[model samples]
Target: MRTNILLASLVVLGFACQPTKQKEETASTPEKIAVPVLTKAWETDTVLLTSESVIYDEFRDVLYVSNINAVPPTAKDDDGFISIISTDGEILELNWVNEISAPKGMGIIDSSLFVTNIDEVVEIDIPSGVIVGRYPINGAKFLNDISISSGNEVFISDTGTNTIHVLNNGDVRSWLNDSSLVGPNGLLHQGSHLMVASYGGNEFSRIDINTKMRETITDSIPGGDGIVSYGDHYFVSNWNGEVHFVDTAGNRTLVLDTKTKGQNAADICYIPEKKLLLVPTFFGKSIVAYEVK
Candidate 1:
């Protein structure tokens, strides 16, 4: 009887000590990322004169477009100007600010608007529509885009030299020169990082503001020009007239393709509150608006 009790106890211990049936390892399903559809809402007249970038001024409820009136983009022609348009696509002031040479990307800091030229960052007084300052970046080859950080520091990208220059408190300096820049064109300053759209490698990447470490989000976009955040995803435009919606996992979905139409998509802007996308057609000479659904 004691032996039977001992055997029963041993069996109970063995059962208790036995590992639970390991659940079969299953591959996790990728989170479903919704691809947004873009519907053409409005397009301004084709008189923008090689509009290269469009930025919305929320305070004024207007849109600012940079017109590189000269070809070869790097030309120091004095005809480049900034145009102002109403949110409803009406031309407010065709030459709100002129005399800029090959202006490309622009950002507004408080009452001042900063724009990227060939080797200089021009600061414009928004209310007065006057060019207040021009900060020249030394050794800058082709300054392409401008993004202002929360701290009001203006960051500019140079595609010709794979460099990034910064303007802080009237001081202009070369901030970064990484080979990984690969013709960085468009810059968007997020909270802790800057999103870069590369024209050479056809890549969209992020650079940590603190560490300066570069992380590629995708490399499939050809002639990447503009980048805008949409929730956790992004909307990036190709200089060849293709706009792609990129998910968190780097998967891209083509949202707009104007390549066949011979239209070029340059630096783009997104208005989250209205779910509106503003695309600058470089050669098309127009600002196209689309409602993203």
Candidate 2:
């Protein structure tokens, strides 16, 4: 009987020595992202016709929109044009410059407006509404967005060929033609560097103009078509109808989403003075404005 009591005592001691099991807390909790205040200011009529890029021209105090009216976006059928619109959503000129085909981007240098065509960069006299010069990038398949620096240097992205061509003193040459560019779509000249938004991948990078070095900033916005930075915050638009407001610290918040509505957000432009973001809906054939605070 003593032996049986000792064995039972040992069993009790074994149970007491075992560690208590407590539920573990998760390592990373899903953060509650604040939906930014995206108030719809105004949406233009259906006259834009496949608007791809919308840029605010501070010189003219208006916005220029590139429209591809053809079914095949890359077609050069003399139907593509640029439209002028007021900040209050009025169509100033339905067809501002009617000579270009498949115009995709617009950049200003003095009195000229530089635009990207299928495989060429067309320079137009803004005051005269005439095509002044055409710099063709030979063997370029799809020339996309255009970025002009304060020093009047121009850069254009070729998404089809995965390259970027630069125009220095009216001479157009391929600056960087590597696959590492990763389908560069939107080109933004931010001071000393050029910010690239990759359409083929979900990333944004800053590239050194001289060294061709790249520093990826974020890889959250897939199909990122347009990017603009203001006050340590970046406004990025995915072609899939979503816009993200990302701070310099790499925090992403879904500021706008129109995917459920079956609309698109292509190349967008922002006006810092008015705190407005203009988004071009590709298939929707309209340019929309949202007040960003």
Using lDDT as the measure, the top candidate is 1
Which runs in model 2 stand beyond 4 Å of their true positions? 1-36
**Could you tell me which 10 consecutive residues in candidate 1 have the lowest summed lDDT?**
18-27
| lDDT value, candidate 1, whole model | 0.90
Global lDDT scores for all candidate models = 0.90, 0.85
RMSD (Å) per prediction: 3.7, 7.8
Error of 1 at 68 (Å): 0.4
Regions of candidate 1 where Cα sits further than 4 Å from its true position: 1-28
Best by TM-score: 1
Tell me how far the alpha carbon of residue 166 in candidate 1 is from the true structure, in angstroms, after superposition: 1.2
User: Candidate 1 at residue 218, lDDT?
Assistant: 86
lDDT of 2 by residue, 128-163 (tens): 888899988898988989888888889899999989
Q: Could you give candidate 1's per-residue lDDT for residues 79-164 as a string of tens digits?
A: 99999998778998998898987999889889998999998999999999988898888888899988888998898999999998
